[model samples]
Target: MAVAAPQTSEGQPPKIKASAASLIDVGSGQIYFQKEGDKRREPASLTKIMTAILAIEKGDLKDVVTVRKRAAAVSMGQDIGLKSGDKLYLEDLLKAALMYSANDSTVAIGEHIAGEHDLFVKMMNDKAKSLGMKNTNFANTNGFHHPNHYTTANDLAILTSYALQNETFAKIVSTEEAVITWLPDEESKSVTENGEEKPLKQRTIHSTNRLLRSDYQGINGVKTGTTPRAGNCLVASAAREGRQLAVVILNSNNRWNDATRLLDYGFKEVRPVVLAEKDELVTELEVREGLEKRVSLVALERLEVYVPRIEVEKIQRKVVLTPAPEAPVKRGDKLGKMKFYLDDKELGAVDLVANQDVDRLSWFKRLFDKS
Candidate 1:
């Protein structure tokens, strides 16, 4: 299902120059602004974010992978200088792919994880479909300008939201600098010391995303991409005062500036408000043939919504129940629904459940009790 774009309570949305762009509040999964967000465009190196996340999920970070000739031959992009037969841990490759945007590292990761380039690309497409990124497809792992390889700003934002939840992926993308060691080159390995292998080669890599280097407050990172076909693209995220926001821009010359503006607008315009607290008693339900005349119902979890300050007054909660549940109701059994709404639009709903079990009244007790 697609998430609806959020509308402002007052005033017009901030203008952006990107062909496709989106801004979303992380905590509430609310879209603050969107322009052609569903339009498909090349993702460039930003595709590595998906590759990195899948690698993390499928294998151990410390697992070593031997670089293949094909992996080192990713066409039309920069590599981390991996050579055939070079061995490195998956964690190091992830650092290179994310921090340096090295296409070869991603290829190595793809091959290591899926055993073939085509299979890995298939997995990428499968994951995209599972994440509800309907407009995305993957022809290759490193995102080297294939006609079949494309994604939309909205789809990229969805992928980023899922990736950011992984602590390892978040740490790798946010890193500004990292150093990784690889096996010595053939020439270096040919000359050993005292009939033993020499030390490995270490290289330092820096992030290609400029926002992480600049003084933009709380600019944690997501990713950056550039290609002749895609122009400049970036997925950016930041956290402030326990709230986080993510921005996506595709095919924009002013991606950084536009993303910052969108983020600024979201932080200033959207405010997070608690609609209901976890286990808060909403209402009591009349029990039929239960030992207890009434049973309490409570919210399963805290419900929070992000809305414009002016629309906060319009927020409301509705409790809906089934025909009075018969006795023998177990705690945590779903009895009703608690729906949160902003004006006429429904935000979300949670199950309202019985707080404690209520047993059916005994026949003897029922017979003796005459109203």
Candidate 2:
């Protein structure tokens, strides 16, 4: 079988899947390579990722939400069989929406968060715009097919970057399966919904993400989506040897295969090398009028770098350290920044932390400290 060569026009490298995509180096906010990552495409249930985040941020998990007609309206895609007027807690609804891609759960969660479906959709678009997702829009929280509901692979990646900041949101998304049990009714005397609480046993829920399963190593929670127009999309992350990587793929025919390819590429082709370790001093700052002559400065967080191993030798790296003046500096002050560069391009920056407290110099010491 003859393998097709890359198409070229004016002596340029053949175009890869510009319509496909990936994003890596999560912490440093670096994009190794991408295809039509910014191209507008259907998000499918991956829209639930944003819905989950919004619920986490704006809705109280303990709050009660009586499923409304709109919430229980006949919808399409993944569902948890919610009925009209069904009573459930915010937490359960969130789990359902995220794990099962329940359209009802999405509507219910949206209502609970933004007080209405329309408003919740607005927030989704607003957040997308704020994240610089210039080519995205949201008409519903459930990600059902709509003429206007659209998002890009890069936009999804950006959303993941912000969504992971919420620790709880991050945990729930990555969970393989969760058993969610709640009282059929918050009160025994309360009207029964879902055929009574029935002794309140754990109802197990499994994660759609296989990476979080025991079979896979270093894989954690993220989101996945598929639609006729969007194909298969995934925003996934994994941690190995003290390094974490987030990968996003869009417009793929084979969802799992694309995810595997991107993740394998990250681990094999562009694993994050430890440019600097936590608490490792990259430089020192001279204390002008403090008890110590100098203060050690180190990276606040572990510095893991992601780059193509094939380009490892060619991947030039440099650290720019900005040390703060020592005098009157409090312990743990964010005095400076550590910037790591690869191949003349600024890859990322981490906040440099002060090693210790620097007390104000005494009158006598202040006058003679410079001497």
Candidate 3:
């Protein structure tokens, strides 16, 4: 059966079929659009995102993990056919868990990293709390159908944004396909043409995210999930001209089209505006008892933020300068700050620094000037 497309009109949010959805600017954490954003829903395999995060932070990728009986017993959902006593690198397991949404791989990773299945689930919950995911809970390492396993679109967006900050996580999620190797049990090891035993068995895994495989421009990552209760869930991220946006959709009737339309709307609605340019002269600050009475202050770095096109003129700039200070003031010395805001929300801020040196006036010069 063909899925119905989301309804949309000019200058309005697309009426997606997702039960819960959120579109956010990755850099500024600005929410572009949301629908039932705080309503908790089953996350399905999206739980692997948090699993991958803990694995990268707590375990060495090079470490070899022996598949446990519990991991081998995971047969309910997608799996890599791992068996007890099979050995693989942690990195390979991460690839399977994330790219393939392999339920068995997540258990192995959780066991290897936390040394216990329940402990790893606890760690996932603890990490969620730290990330300010207030409406999230994890009942398992892999997002199996558990009564307690639930999260909201808002929380998932926050989690994905934090996870993307890790270079390894980002690289892994953005990958379209990967080959992972594992050491099979002695009985299952294959023999080569030359009569030598092949120590490593290779498996090629492709990302389950259809958008990533499509011709969608800037489509990067992140993950997709499905189960009876969760329906079609996806956390999709894309980058364009250095600006990244993430969309979280849970229990959607048409996840791909819904995500595509929402992302398109977001890109069209918001744009990156350069609030301040690096080294641009902001203003002059008065220096007391210095060779020069005033010192030039320039922005220390470029400040750019994504704001809705309608709110571009609403942005307010506030300059805060340090109280007049006695020289010597060296170039690059911290002098003040320039803050950009939209209404009361702070969009971005940059340090303002002295543009040149200002030495204190000599006592002789001070005395002559006094005369």
Candidate 4:
């Protein structure tokens, strides 16, 4: 089935049935498809994605946390088998929280990080604000239903993109299954025949995201959520040939189907095209009063952008250079700018820089040349 991406001025997008959905080209930050993307709704366990990322950032993985009573008492339907007084590393707790949608584990992480779950919720909201998630708010760390707790598909997509930039967060969500070992408490570390501490017990769990295990190509991680209010929701990421896409679906009966369809459509409908390559000579401009008669201008950085596959040829390029830059120009001197547009609307721009240094002519030579 086809899912409509955002309608470009040049082409029509396909139609989709999800209540709220968004698809982005992860590499170029291009919105391929979106339907009510900014409308807020309960995110369910998908809230744990933000929780996991924060824990990874603020806590040391090796630190062992003694599970608190409140953490073990989260609202039902999910758990990491955590009990009050049980000890587990921060890393293991995060693994359980993200992969298994473990509400208890998520609470344990929140409590450990903020000394209380409510405080951690504040942190989530604060981070959301800082990340420009205007439509997002958090009332709990584990996504237990609270009318105040909500996020939008667009916000979740933004969160996923930011979290994936952290290697640790990305690695954790991408994991299909992980063996979490809980460090035994002092009470449980009774002396054996040799009087040595017993090895920690291990529990293996699989990711809640079935796309990771399915035949879907390049499926990585992200998360899935379900609640009476939110229905089935999913934030999924996939990559091919170095190009990546993130899809978010909220309140959908066919979340998996919708997410996969959006990704499949994105790869076919839009692709990244290099507008300008770094250090590639763009234009040669006359250099006034320099050792050399001319200087080559080049792009200071690579300029790659995403465009609808069919409209790649329609992109317009304009070079705007500084008016007559006098020489003794340095190799990296900013000389001008390259602006890109589609249908007269600006897409992006990059700096044009000097390709190489050009020293001024000696005084004697300058005088002789002038004569």
Better of 2 and 4 by TM-score: 4
Clashes of 3: 0
Native-structure RMSD, model 4 = 4.7
The CA lDDT of each predicted structure is: 0.85, 0.71, 0.89, 0.84
By lDDT, the better pick of 2 and 4 is 4
Could you tell me which residue pairs clash in candidate 3?
none
TM-score of each: 0.80, 0.69, 0.79, 0.80
Q: Kindly list the per-residue Cα lDDT of model 1 for residues 174-289, writing each as its tens digit.
A: 99999888866566674466688754888899988888877676889888898999988899999888888999988897787777777776777777778888899989999888
Candidate 4 lDDT tens digits, 118-202: 8998999999999888999999887888989999988888888888878888888899989988787766675579888765677
Candidate 4 residue 96 C-alpha distance from true site, Å: 1.3
lDDT of each residue in 44-91, candidate 3, tens digit only? 999999999999999999999999999999999899999898899999
TM-score of candidate 4 to 2 decimals: 0.80
Q: Which residue pairs in candidate 1 have backbone atoms (N, alpha carbon, C) closer than 3 angstroms, thus clashing?
A: none
List the candidate 4 regions with Cα displacement exceeding 4 Å: 1-14, 190-196, 199-202, 277-302, 310-332, 341-347, 354-371
lDDT of 1: 0.85
* Candidate 2 structure quality by residue, lDDT tens digits, 1-371: 11232243433223334256756655655666567777778888889988888778777889888777888885676667666767778888888877656777889788777888899899988878887888888998877889999887777777777787788887778776766654455555333586543644345667666556534556776877777777767778877776566777776655554555565556555655676678878777877767887887888888666776655566544545554474788777776777766657776677777889888789887778557
- Candidate 3 error regions (>4 Å): 1-13, 25-31, 36-39, 129-135, 145-148, 165-168, 175-182, 186-189, 199-205, 277-298, 323-333, 353-371
Kindly report which residue stretches of model 1 are placed more than 4 angstroms away from their true locations once superposed.
1-12, 185-200, 277-302, 310-318, 326-334, 341-346, 350-371
User: How many backbone collisions does model 4 have?
Assistant: 3
